[model samples]
Target chain A: MTTALTVETDPAQLCCEPSSQPVLNAVDAQESARVLKALSDPNRLRLLSIVKAGDGGEACVCDLTEPLDLGQPTVSHHLKILVDAGLLEREKRGTWAYYSLVPGALEAASARILGL
Target chain B: MTTALTVETDPAQLCCEPSSQPVLNAVDAQESARVLKALSDPNRLRLLSIVKAGDGGEACVCDLTEPLDLGQPTVSHHLKILVDAGLLEREKRGTWAYYSLVPGALEAASARILGL
Candidate 1:
C-alpha cells in the first residue's frame, strides 16, 4: 500500500507546479528590496516630496526641518538615507547641503516594482 | 551681540526656506510608506513576481514555496502582507489557495512614488 501511494504521487500531477519563471531573480529582488526599504519610512517620503517641490527642484537641510517639524539632525539623517538609496543627490553649496531628486530615480524605482 | 545677530537674521534671507509645498502631505506619506513597507521585503518581491508570471496570472500557495526554498507558512505570511497592501488578491479553489496581482495596484503604487 505504501509503495503504491508513493508511485501514484507523480511530480507532473501536482496541482501547484510553477507555471512560469519569475522575471525578478533573487539578486535583483534583493537590490529592489533595498531601494523599497529606504522608501518605507514616512519621514523619508515627506523629505523627498519637500525636496522635489523646492526651488529649482532642490531643498536645503535647513529648509527641511520646519515643514516636518523635525530637528535638523533627524531630517539630515533621513536625507542621508535617501542619498544612499540613490533616490536623492546631495550637493554642498557654501556651508549648506542642498538635496535634489536624482533624475529618473523615482521612475526607475517604479519600473523596478512593476517589472518585478 | 545677541541683539545684533537677531537683527542680521532675516527669514526671507534664509537659505533653507522652502520654495514650495510638498505634494505629499504627512498623512499621505504615512499611507504610501505602508504600501512601500509591504513591498520592501526581498521574499515578498519575489513572491509578487512569481504570482505575476504564474499561469493565468495566478499561482497556488503550494507552488510558491519551492521557488524560494521557503516553507509554506513563511510564503503565506509574505502573501498576506501583499494582500493587505492591496497589491495582491487571494482566492480559494478546492483545497488550494491561489494568488494573483491586483489590477492597477502596482501602477497605483508607482504613481504614489512618482507623484510624490
Candidate 2:
C-alpha cells in the first residue's frame, strides 16, 4: 500500500523564528515533542541512519535486516515507527518493501528547536 | 550556580546528509535518537516553545509558570529535562533561573531526520 504524506518545511527552520525573535507557542511545543519521541530510540535511530545511508537514499527490508544485526521483525517494527512518525516513507515493490526518508520531516522538526 | 553547556548543530541538518546521499551511521542513529527522545514530550515541547518565544530569546521561572498553567515545580522539572537534553541553557540571574534555547540543537536533530 502507498501512503501519501505531506512534507512540511525543514523542521530545523520550522521549529522557531529568527534568533532575535520568538514565535513558538504552546501548540508548537506539543507537536514538536511528539516528533522527538519518535526518534528517541537507539534502534530506531540506527534504522534511520541505515535508511538514509542506503543507495538512492532508500533501503529495502531484506537489505536493512543484516546491517542492523536485528531480527527481520524487529527491523520491520522500527521502520514502522519511523513511517508512523513521518520520518520515513514506505513503498512496496513486488514482495519487498523499500523505505525512504521524508524530505522535510527532519528539517521542520529541527527548525522548530533551533529557531534557525 | 551556572551550568555551561555546548550547543550542537541544528538537529534537522545534523541528522542526515543531502538527498540522493546517505551518511548516517550506527553511532549517529543512537545519538540522534537520544536527542529525539528528549523532545518527545507535550509539556517539554510547550515549555520550549514558551522559552523560544520569550523576550531576549529567554524566559525566567516566574514568567513561565502562569502561561503553562503548571505548578512551579513541574515547570522547573520540565526545564531541567530540556536543559539536560541540551535543548536549552539555564542561567541564574539573581534569585530566578532563566532559560534559553540552545542554538543548533534543534537544527541538528531535524537535519538528521530530513537528511538535509
Candidate 3:
C-alpha cells in the first residue's frame, strides 16, 4: 500500500478505509506554506546550501558573498528572509553576522509532502 | 559536528575541511526553488495533502473538493500546479482526471536543505 498506482492504466481502488489517515488542516497548511514560500527563491536556497555545507554547518554573510558573487546587502536580505521563515538563525558578532540552519526546519518541510 | 552552535556564546570554529561537501549550483537551485515555490501556497499544500492521504495515494478533483470546500475549478487549478511542478502525475479518463504523487520529488526537495 506504500506505492500508489497510476489511475490511467488501472481502475481506481481504495487501498485503505476512508479517512484512515488524518489530513492537513487549513491552519497547518497556511503555516507550512509560509515557511516554504520563504525558501522558494533560488538565491535563498543557495545561501542555505552554503551555510549548511560550511564548516560547523554555519557561515557568515561575508563568507557567503565572495562565492555567491552577490553584494553584502543582497546576501543579508536573503538571510533575513530565511531567518524570518525560521529556517535559519542569525547572530551578530562585533561586525559580522553569521547564519546557521535551524534544527528540524528542513525535516518539517520534508514531512509535508509525505502528508505529515 | 552535526550540531552547529548559535554563535552567541561561542567563538566560530571550522569543524570540517573547506568545501568538503558539494553545494547546490544556480541551475539546481532555480529548478528546486521552482518546485518548492509551487508547493508554497497554503491551498495548494492542502490539496496535495488530501491527494497524498487518499487511500490509493491518489484522488480526483471531486474527491478533494468536499473536504476542501473548494469549487471544482479551484481544486483543479491547484492540482494542475502540482502536476506542472512534477509533484503529481495527472491522467485523464473519460472525464475525470486522477492524480498521484511523483516519486522522489519530495525527497529531492528535502535533500536540498541537507545540502544534497
TM-score of the second chain, each candidate in turn, equals 0.86, 0.74, 0.73
The candidate scoring highest on lDDT is 1
Candidate 3 chain B, run of 10 with poorest lDDT: B12-21
Top candidate, metric TM-score: 1
All candidates: CA RMSD (Å): 2.7, 18.3, 10.9
lDDT of each: 0.86, 0.69, 0.74
Quickly count the clashes in candidate 3.
Answer: 0
Interface RMSD for all numbered candidates? 2.3, 9.6, 5.4
All candidates in order of DockQ, best leading: 1, 3, 2
Q: Is the docking of candidate 1 incorrect, acceptable, medium or high quality?
A: medium
Query: Worst lDDT window (10 residues) for model 1 chain A?
Result: A11-20
User: What is candidate 2's DockQ?
Assistant: 0.21
lDDT measured at residue B97 in model 2 versus the true structure, 0 to 100: 76
State which candidate has the highest DockQ. Answer: 1
Task: Please provide, for model 3 over B38-111, each residue's C-alpha lDDT reduced to its tens digit, 9 standing for 90 to 100.
Answer: 88998888777777777587876546666767787888888888889988898776656777788777777666
Which is the better candidate, 2 or 3, if ranked by DockQ?
3
- For model 2, how does the per-residue alpha-carbon lDDT over A6-113 read when each residue is reduced to its tens digit? 235433333333233224565666676667777788777767767767779787766676665778788888888888888899998766688988987766666765
- For candidate 2, lDDT tens digit of each residue in B26-89? 6766677767777788777777777767878787766676666778789888788788878899
